[model samples]
Target: MNQQLPLLFPNAISLTIKREDLIHPFVSGNKFRKLKYNLLQAETQQYKTLLTFGGAFSNHIAAVAYAGKEKGFKTIGIIRGDELGSKISENPTLSFAENCGMQLEFISREEYRLKSELSFIENLKAKFGDFYLIPEGGTNALAIKGCQEILTPEDAEFDYICCSIGTGGTISGIINSALPHQKVLGFPALKGDFLKEEIRSFVNKENWELLTDYHFGGYGKVNEVLIGFINSFYQKNKIPLDPIYTGKMVFGVIDLIQKNFFPAQSKILLIHTGGIQGIQGMNMKLRNKKLPIIEIND
Candidate 1:
């Protein structure tokens, strides 16, 4: 479930990556860590089906759908947005989830806002009884338990740990697992607008710091600079990084390094939270830009 990949710029300073992105094909990356316990709990409760909510291009939805299909559980994705009806190709995430055997239920944003209410759960249960419901990004206590296991095996002590922030589940788990001596930096994929307060509310750790500038545009948004950095990274390390999550976090980390935020000799570990399906959509959007395509040249 992990891989030891050397830092591309390693020198006197020690840098390592916890390659959780390579964990499983369907249950890939941080999503796998976050969902492991939830799945187990579902099985323990004898749940025959799983239901979750997310937006159009949510990595959580994709992971859950694929995992459910592979594990032989019925899955439903309560997606936020109107159904495009026969226009499935318009959104790659929706297309992939359907192909993976997930039942898609589209709802308006207004309906999605009532997601956490008991009334909503009761209504859903009345229609689809006894199904296990996993919150978006699997940010529950059980999920955190699975993510905590990610940091336990590392023998080398790091001065700092960095990871991209989505629902803050992974960062919360990392911060909770980190030693008192280590600092955790979260580069949020969402804008700083309310993310700082959101993360703080989740894990009230003294050593955690949220960097808001790296979000490029916003969630699922990218620009020329991010595309360029993603291209350069693959060229240098031959590691594929999707632009939405890990690429943005890596971009932020490099900028921090250049800013001398940490001493040159600082040992750091960065978590690669995979979102490879995100690349398919991003590539389609960037296809017209003539961005340096990361094709095998040899």
Candidate 2:
């Protein structure tokens, strides 16, 4: 559903949000889109086990676990940070995945860096037998195929489409399907230019650009001001924005609007790629540091 935000911005610029978070209770937003075709491919190949990777608060891990269970497939999560293996009970995300019957294997950060290496995958196959593999952020050709369906014909009226970028899968799909007149803007959760290549590899269009200023502190990092913005945004819109991704993008878009980055009367659409499931985990971190936590209806 497209929800027009009531934020009072100058220049008569319009802001609307695509509520992809409502896509599913567990496999919400881009995860649902990325996993739709992947799950189908796994079944088509007659795979009974699905294996993927993620960190402690990873939305992909939780989604894959729930989606696997729902589709009657065994799920395995190769989690980063070996220390988290014993702390599963203290971690909301890991605990949720475990409750959904996902086998969790925690690895050291050093070893986790080789996640995409062929030898590392071979070792996993040797231990777990046969399984369909999904990348860390669930970005793959099939995932792009699924995400491409996020935009509808009605969305063609918007001048700019904005979304959060992780592994570049979601925005690539958007860039592929976006009209030539509409510009797609990506706000990376991480701080890096490598995403330009990652996005370019999957998309052939030049209608998109990345706004790197909104990362706040990088992936999974948020400060008090951002937390304040998220809380206030939800209070006004009654829509929960995840701190890691959607919140940052929304913050950036609004900041740009106030700075006159966009022309007058421009219509902007924000893609609310869901990450509400990570809020409990994020709140736990906030309490440890004495920072304000993100507030939502949940």
Residues forming the 10-long window of minimal summed lDDT in candidate 2: 289-298
Error of 1 at 39 (Å): 0.6
Which portions of model 2 miss their true places by more than 4 Å? none
Estimated TM-score per prediction?
0.90, 0.99
lDDT (Cα atoms) of all candidates against the true structure: 0.80, 0.96
RMSD in angstroms, all models?
2.7, 0.6
What would you estimate as the lDDT of candidate 1? 0.80
Error of 2 at 124 (Å): 0.4
Q: Identify the candidate with maximal TM-score.
A: 2
Q: How far is candidate 2 from the true structure (C-alpha RMSD, Å)?
A: 0.6
Cα lDDT of model 2 overall?
0.96
Query: Model 2, 1-298: lDDT tens per residue?
Result: 9999988899999999999999999999999999999999999999999999999999999999999999999999999999998999999999999999999999999999999999999999999999999999999999999999999999988999999999999999999999989999999999988899999999999999999999997899899999999999989989999999999999999999989999999999999999899999999999999888888877
lDDT tens digits, residues 1-298, model 1? 3343455443356556777777887678888998898999889999989999988778889999998987889998888876643556787888988898998888788988998899998998998777999997778888777877778655347888889988878888888888888999999888865766665766667888888899988988888788788887778767778788888998988887777788877888888888876777677667767654433222
The prediction achieving the highest lDDT against the true structure is 2
Model 1: clashing residue pairs?
none
